[model samples]
Target: MFTGIVEATGEVTALDLRGGDVRLRIRANSLDLSKIQLGDSIATNGVCLTVASLLEDGYESDVSSETLSVTSVSSWHIGTKVNLERALTIDTRLGGHLVLGHVDGIGEVVHLNPDARSWCLRICAPNELAKYIAQKGSITVDGTSLTVNKVEGAEFELNIVPHTLEHTGIGSYQAGSLVNLEVDVIARYVERLLLGDSAANT
Candidate 1:
């Protein structure tokens, strides 16, 4: 789990396309090497990836074919900078909210309007996931947790502060950019309750 707080920005140094998967070596620019370890799960742009090897300044992880097919990682390449977050610990402060590091689907960046102090970004998401998004509700975009400022059909707006723009990949977003998305866990349960599904049924 993560609090949606970004620790540092890491760059993809290399991606060795292994037969069925890819072994990725990431260069941590602002990532803390002290807090990382082998087998530790990290949230890379909202996708939960296990560390396969720990290097001097970065780490290596493998991305499965399914993970590539589902999320936006397929387009990723060397030099791609990504938001990095070590898995949440019991003693960690909850600055964002509960994040599973499991991205449900991809959302497209349709609008990014920059202003004096902040940026207004609008994304178009899958219609099915629309119900899970709410105005002022929690949502994770590319591993960075943010609140929904507005909602219209399959589109939602997010206000990005300077800190967010400086810390996460959303700062580099443009029209037609595809980003990973995770809806709030509580909202999922609430929707299921409203839909009449229960634990007994499943």
Candidate 2:
């Protein structure tokens, strides 16, 4: 599990295609790598990837065919900047909401405009995932947790502060950019529980 707090920004150094899967190599810019080990989980752009191999300054993981089909990873290219966050430990502070590093769906940037010092970003989410989002609720976009400023049907708005713009890849977003999105974990559980015994079939 993760807290959706980006520790650093990493760059995709290489992408090796192997049969149906692709091996992803990322170079950490500021994320500490000393504590990481083989099999450790790292949230990369909202996708939980196992550290298949450790590198001198980064790591490599295999992106399964299924993952590529469901995420923006298929569009990732060399030099792509990704949000990086190590898996949270018990002592870690929960500055953001609980995130599973599971991309529930992909969203598209519909609009981006400056709001004084901050930037207002509007994204159009998949219709199926719309019910999971709410105004003022937490949403993880490319692994960075952000609050929803407003919700209109399948589209939601967010206020991105200058700090976020400088630290994460969100600042580079433009219209039509695809992003990995993970809704709040708690909301998914609550919805399942509300389904009562009927949830078992699902």
Candidate 3:
């Protein structure tokens, strides 16, 4: 699990495509990788990728075909910079909501405009995932936790302060940008409990 709090921004140094799968290497920027070991999980752009190898400046991970198909990783280029977050430990602070590093659905940025002191982004979520999103709810976008300012059908608006833009990969987003999205983990569990027997009966 992750907290959706991005520790640093890493640059994608290389990408090796093996049929449908991929091997990705990233330069870990200012992030501390001294304590990280191989087989440990790291959230990169909201996808949980295991650290396959340690590099001088960063690490490498293998992306499965299913992960490539479900998220925006397939479109990432060599120079693409990604938000990075380590998995939560028992002593880790929950600064942000609990995130599984599982990309539920990919969303598209429909509008990005400058507001008074911040920027306003309107993203269109997948129809199936839209129902789970609520106004004032938390949603992880490109590995950054953001509150939903407003929700209209399958689209939602977010107010991004200058600090957030500078800290995460969200600053580089454009209107046509594709992003990895993970809805609140609590909401999913609640829905399952409410459905209960009905879900099993089906």
Best by lDDT: 2
TM-score of 2: 0.98
Worst 10 residues of 2 by lDDT: 183-192
lDDT values of the candidates? 0.90, 0.96, 0.94
lDDT of 2 by residue, 1-202 (tens): 9998899999999999999999999998889999999999999999999999999999999999999999999999999999999999999999999999989999999999999999999999999999999999999999999999999999999999999999999999999999999999889889999999989998
TM-score order, best first, reads 2, 3, 1
**Local error of candidate 3 at residue 74 (angstroms):** 0.4
Tens digit per residue, CA lDDT, model 3, 79-198: 999999999999999998999999999999998899998999999999999988999999999889999999999999999999888899888899899999999988988988999789
lDDT by residue for model 1 over 10-121, one digit each (tens)? 9889989999798988887768878777899988888899999998879999999999988888889998889999998889999998999989899999989987899999
TM-score attained by model 3: 0.97
In model 1, the clashing pairs are none
Q: Where does candidate 1 stray beyond 4 Å? A: 194-202
